[model samples]
Target: MTEDEALELLIPGVKSKKLSLEDERKSKDLVKMLGYLPLAIDQVRGFLTEAGYATSIDKYVDVFEKHKEKVIKPVGVVPNAMVQRSNLYTTFELSLAPFVEAGNEPALRILMLGAFFGLAPIDEAIFLEYRKVQPAEARPAMPAQDPWDQIRFRRTVLSLAEQSLVKLHSQQDRFAYSLHPMIREWLRLRVDTNPRSVITWRPWT
Candidate 1:
């Protein structure tokens, strides 16, 4: 969407009531800052219209500027993809902040490792294999003698799905999940940021 379309989307009633000149300008700038992507726009709209985020466009823009760098940088650029990778990364990073702050390593590990699998709907079994061999640091904290099990596995993966970081697919006998391609790239970028935290491996054959 163009800046005008995004502004209207950000402010649902823009057509009915005239916004102040200052507000109109700031809103358009905010839309541009969000990379003019509708998903980013909608997420920012939620921030503005809802509680617990910046109260106004000015403050929200400030928040985005401050935290954007905290998101891992995209490693390789793709030309003219429908979604801007930087903004998508920033948007999801902000969404994931609470989990990170809470130190939910299991959920974060599941999300990061899932990206290593190709874009196909990943079979749950591959994640089972991952849990067995992932680096000690990357593995979720649990008792040394206790084994990770199916119930715990589903809980962690479901957490990622709840955040929209991964798409969950349910079949009659099992569950599978996949990430959006760009999001997969973002996750890989995250993994690349800290080499010691990840173990090298080929994507499942």
Candidate 2:
């Protein structure tokens, strides 16, 4: 979708008369940075609406500019699919923000680990095994005596699936999960950009 079309769909009753030319330009820039995806645009709209004092298009544009390199990048099979590539990353970050903000360590670790496993379906057993071998310091602290409780790990994975950050696929009696390619790239970018995040890929035994 074009930036204009996305803006109209995301914010009903947004008219040219209500927005100044500079604001319109900033809105367009924001939309472009978001890859003109309806989902991403809607996410930004929700964030802005919630942040009443900081709802200006200009302010959003400034924020976008700062992280544009990390969030915006081209990736797709088809030519001219750069924007579509960006759509997934932009929306993925929006979906992930809540977990990060709440400091949900289990959920964050699940997501970060999932990204290392590639975009294909990841067997649930792999994560279960990882939990068994994962060091106590690696696991999120829990109220229960066992920090690596399997039940808590399962719940965290399910929550990530519910948020659409991970796609859950079931075949026959077994279930596996996968992340969108864009989301995997976004997570990789996060690890690369932040010196504090420690992510390592290890074969599932």
Candidate 3:
């Protein structure tokens, strides 16, 4: 409060935010629960997108058209997820649903890995070098365990294929995947997006 306001508060008194120690602990728990909300929502979004083309729940749900059956709540039920879908999560899923259906978890992981690698062109040999595990630090979930794991290899090819985010071609000997128009088109938009331009300096420009 300003000096004048402080004087007025002394004359009349005012309430302020004060939390008890117990409330602080509860608040921390609430925050931890809230933190997982985004992660759960992300997983659910991925699951639903892989499931099918989802739209607003209201889009297909017509109160007039729906018939109530013997149940108290009424048997003719459309889904809530199907009813209200328009935000970025829903829209993105709709765009990528086909590929997701064609390519599941393995595929999605592969595509994300490619995105991380600057959307570079990739083939099995190149993929082997980049994707292979270090002998000193290999984990069970990594690719090196079973080199002939088609399940592991195809996960990547299908994901890129489904999003139209990549161009995938294969020869008799190996498979090749390259960044599709998606990243190429998206890159141009980042020309002046250097919020950290201070750190992103040049040697001679």
Candidate 4:
């Protein structure tokens, strides 16, 4: 309904003895409608998987269990990302070499870190657990990915944007860049590519 029509339908209840009459009728109507609520609950529970309830007996079988009352069970996923990691490293050797030559160390670091995080922007649990070193230890002199780090990262982003290795996504208040498919493919190759070949682009002072 339009705003005018909705306003017309509203009673705009007044504060008076008539309020009790209205309340009584409304309460009766509510109770009448909800009298069969238990039946409705049973139907809803059967039709939908509530939280903490078992959906299966085992990972491979259908022996369901209850996690909690009304809540469903087995709402978890195991980490099985190793295979994808292995595949990514074998394919993008060519794209990585150029960044090394271009001396884009910050960008290179971000890309490598992205790989370790999986093919996702979300920090992967496995990636977070296996720290080569903390960022402070890893590159102490270089600033963290903070406002200052943006100076270097933004420069790298623009550089990559020029080569179409990355694509920029901008909103009114926030902006970020993502790897182009080619860059994504190359970063995946990090798993298998030679560690020695991946050089830091930071030049000697």
Best candidate, TM-score? 1
Q: Stretches of candidate 4 above 4 Å error?
A: 1-97, 116-135, 138-147, 180-185, 192-205
Q: lDDT at 197 for candidate 1? A: 47
How does model 3 score by TM-score? 0.35
Q: Candidate 4 residues 71-178, lDDT tens each? A: 111212121333222222211222234567676566566565454333333222322333434454454323245324445655776654443444565556445555
Candidate 2's TM-score: 0.53
User: Tens digit of lDDT per residue, candidate 2, span 1-205?
Assistant: 9766877855667774587777677777777766677656765776665566365777665665554445543322232456566555655665567777887776776677777786579876765565578765664422222534656756776777766677777778666778777677666655532353465322112
Output the number of the lDDT-best candidate: 1
lDDT score, candidate 3, position 89: 22
Between candidates 1 and 3, the lDDT winner: 1
lDDT of 3 by residue, 1-205 (tens): 2432432222222224344655344433422322323322232333334445253223212211231111112222233432221122232334344545574545544544454345556666765664454342443223443455765576656654544445677778777786544333222321222343211111111
Task: For candidate 4, report its TM-score.
Answer: 0.34
Candidate 4 or 1, higher lDDT? 1
| TM-score of candidate 1 against the unseen true structure | 0.61
Q: Is candidate 2 or candidate 3 better by TM-score?
A: 2
C-alpha lDDT of candidate 2 relative to the true structure: 0.62
The CA lDDT of each predicted structure is 0.66, 0.62, 0.39, 0.36
Off by over 4 Å in 1: 1-32, 36-58, 70-83, 129-146, 193-205
| Model 4: lDDT to the true structure | 0.36
